[model samples]
Target: MTPNILMTRIDNRLVHGQVGVTWANTLAANLVIVANDDVATDDVQQQLMKMVLPDTIGIRFFTIERTSQIIDKAAPHQKIFIVVKTPQDVLRLLENGVQLEQVNIGNMHYKEGKKQVAPTVSVDDADIEVFKKIKEFNVDLFVQGIPGEKKQDIFNLI
Candidate 1:
């Protein structure tokens, strides 16, 4: 009963205007899954995030462990678009046996300690290490802000 995951993206913002609406439309994703511990437990934040989306698009918030279980048991007809907060989260899911075809690096805005790899992507030393581990899995990883934009491989940038 596993759902067909259309796209998996890493965006620190989780569900935002562009990613929640535009990316969902572009990918034709009927379901949006935000897998993060903090947001999943925050009722106010969850309500706010749900308020922004159109009623037609279903959305769910689950912790990483719960998300792995859901992904493993998703319905085949469901087109799931997953959004996680970090590369480390992605790696955690992979380690838990959540299968994904490719991962899109959406946004990871620059912080004091992070290095800018692209216009939108910035990562610290730990982030780079996580990316390296993900690369080892041979998962197709690239950065594309939106559907029409060109995707740049993380390997090449890092």
Candidate 2:
């Protein structure tokens, strides 16, 4: 099914209080897809994240590949939240033909060997490279949490 609203938020904390509560509500997301291989494989983590999200939201976890499959199918949807843990996962989805024209980076925090773009965004060389891949698909990638806020394209900064 084609996601109604494809929000490519990049919160490394993935499906936590900020995204689980605030961002999802703001986006009016009816479907929440977590595109992370690590978390998807762990039933415990999956269950944990699921509980944090409001019961009103339909939550699904994908290992990046599954996200592409479902998104490529093309279905009528109102708002779909596709949350990837990293830019590489975004590239993976794009490579598999997700057809997302723009990606909204929510958050990627400080980690070992990663650089900070702003107070909320962080990345490593691998992250930048994958973003470059996404650009090949002509996606408008940016770092912003909410609408009307100033957006900084991490790609431009790199």
Candidate 3:
């Protein structure tokens, strides 16, 4: 059976206190999937995430392509909360056949060329263009740091 996708979020900080505790509890997620190429192979990063995550919640680190495949075949009981480092990763998952109806923009920290869109979100020219492409897939994108925070439409911020 197909897994129930609780939430798909783009947070540069893949897994941390806010995500492992606050977001996980709010979403009632059974599994947290960090679909990031770099972290998938980084044993240290994976271990750090494991340290903060509650033992009740399951976690997986996977390359974007692998996440796209496994998500589709996940157990019926799995309620997944997916987090990726960038919009490009989410786009890649879409291209690889991972279905998503909406994506939450969270904590995209500012970099040199990136413009701060929301307090917690920043985007460069390339990111803006990639976001536009994602919109074409009919996926809704909004910015919200936590469960009850007001969601701002990503396009409006960009």
The best-first sequence of candidates by TM-score reads: 3, 1, 2
Best by TM-score: 3
Off by over 4 Å in 1: none
lDDT of 2 by residue, 1-158 (tens): 44676577777778887788787888888888889999888999899898888989888887888777777553586578888887888888887878777788878778799888777887888888888888889989998866657888877766
Error of 2 at 102 (Å): 1.9
TM-score of candidate 1 on Cα atoms, chains taken together: 0.96
Residue pairs in steric clash, candidate 3? none
Which regions of candidate 3 deviate over 4 angstroms?
none
> Which 10 consecutive positions of candidate 2 have the poorest summed lDDT?
69-78
lDDT by candidate, in order shown? 0.90, 0.81, 0.92
TM-score of each model, paired residue for residue: 0.96, 0.87, 0.97
Clashes of 3: 0
Which digits, one per residue and each the tens of the lDDT, describe model 1 over residues 97-156?
A: 898779999999998998899989998889889988887777889999988999999979
lDDT of model 1 at position 86? 95
Instruction: List runs of model 2 lying over 4 Å from the truth.
Output: 146-148
How far is 60's C-alpha from truth in model 3 (Å)? 0.6
Tens digits of per-residue lDDT for model 3 on 57-89?
999999998998788789888889999999999
